[model samples]
Target: MQGLIISALIAIGVIVLLGMTIRIVPQRNVYVVERLGKYRTSLEAGMHILMPFIDKVAYKHSLKEIVRDVPRQSCITKDNIEVSIDGVMYLQVIDPKSASYGVDDYVMAAQQLAQTTLRSVIGKIDLDKTFEERSEINMEVVQAVDEAAQPWGVKVLRYEVADINLPASIKDAMEKQVRAERERRAVVAESEGDRQAAINRSEGDRQAAINRSEGEKQEMINISEGEKMKQINEAEGRARQIELIAQATATGLREVATAVKEDGGEEAVSLRIAEQYVSAFEKLAKESTTLLLPSNLSDVGGTVAGLQKVLKTIDRTQP
Candidate 1:
């Protein structure tokens, strides 16, 4: 029984020794080691050995990326608007020794730095820009934090703004402003439409008036042309009638002259003349006019003398 008890004790001591001397680090993990309470080396993936109690794991760090939530904080914008801002950050431990010894807590340092940087960036812009320029705010925070966190063995990959909470009064005022702007645009558009419609109607009326005037002008021109044609036709008819009358008178005169040239033409013409003189006197006396008798009315020689005087008067009157 004493020999069995000593063997069990030796086995227990060996297991404890093994546990103190060996370390199995998982993949993408780093184990910081300290010798006599001083940083010695970093143990990586797989198995490692330590020098008994002289070396011990101080800090454990992951090589993979880490996500940390940035605490919500109140920030004032350039416009003096207070807003609540919160975000998230992506980071990774690049150097285990620096991460362990460089800072008390890399995650806290990075998060605090991110918050302060966000506040500074937000203060530089207005509240309206805070909502619109989220990406810029995030980038500024990431760049500033990453630069500051380099000493802590942390690589800040990305920063994202999660939410921006505006005050209720500001939201309501913005809604009212947007609605008024829309209403103003609608009124302006309606007025423009009415003005265009009025312009179109005026143009239509002007065109119609022009068309009517042109029609009237054309009608007047047509009437003038018709009147000119009618006047020309009537004048031509009157000219033709005058020419016919002159021709008829010339033909009658020619017939009379031919009859005068026949046998006994001179004595018949003298006797016909005497009869025309007697007939013209008789018609004149019938109108209650005075008539004077010739002293040689019974003599043929005196009558011939008087007929010769009448022929001279007729010849003087002809063209």
Candidate 2:
């Protein structure tokens, strides 16, 4: 019974020894070893052996990137505007020994430094710039925090400004100003459209008036040309009729003069004169019921002889 208890006690001691000496570090993890309360070595991934009860794990650090959110804090700008600011920070531990011995807590130090740096940067610019230049603010904060965190083996990758809140009164004022600007632009655009439309209408009216004038001028010219042709044709027709009448009268007079020069022309003229005188009496009797007889109406031969004598007298006078 004493031998069995000694064996079991020895086995239990071996197990405890193995547990203290051997260590299996996870991926992307580091274990810092201490000897006599001083840093001895740093353990990487996989299995590591240590001096039992002399060498122990002191600090554990993660090599992976870590993110921490910056708490919201009230900040004053250069323009004396109060705003609430919050952000996030990306960090990585580069050296485990420095991360352990350089600062009490690297993450807490980096985060606190980031908050103070953000306040300082925000106080330098105007409130409007804080909203517009967020990326610049973030970059400034990252640079400042990273530089100060170098001694703590904490590398700051980047910082981002999450939100910047403005007061309600300022928001309302900005909204009113934007609405007024939009209204002014709309009014100007409408005026420009009206001006353009009026110009188009005036141009159309001017063109229509010009076309009407051209048409009226063309119509006047056509009417004047037609009148001119009509007057010319009428004048030509009157001239043709007058010429024909004058020619016919001249031909009849020539025929009468030629007949007068022929033989028996005097006797024929006398007989024709007597017949015309009798015919004139007959025409007057038919027009009226009363007839005026000559004093020697039954002496026809005497009248005929008297006309012959008058014809002989006219013949003797001719050349």
| Whole-model lDDT per candidate | 0.90, 0.90
TM-score of each: 0.62, 0.64
> Runs in model 1 with CA error above 4 Å?
189-319
TM-score of 1: 0.62
Which consecutive 10 residues in model 2 have the weakest lDDT in total? 252-261
Backbone atom clashes (below 3 Å) for every candidate:
0, 0
lDDT of 2 at 104: 98
- Best model per TM-score: 2
In the range 142-254, model 2's lDDT, one tens digit per residue, is 99999999999989999999888878987887789989999999999999999999999999999999999999999999999999999999999899989999999767745
What tens digits encode model 1's per-residue C-alpha lDDT throughout 192-248? 999999999999999999999999999999999999999999999999999999999
| Cα lDDT, model 1, residue 12 | 97
- Tell me the deviation in Å of residue 118 in model 1: 1.5
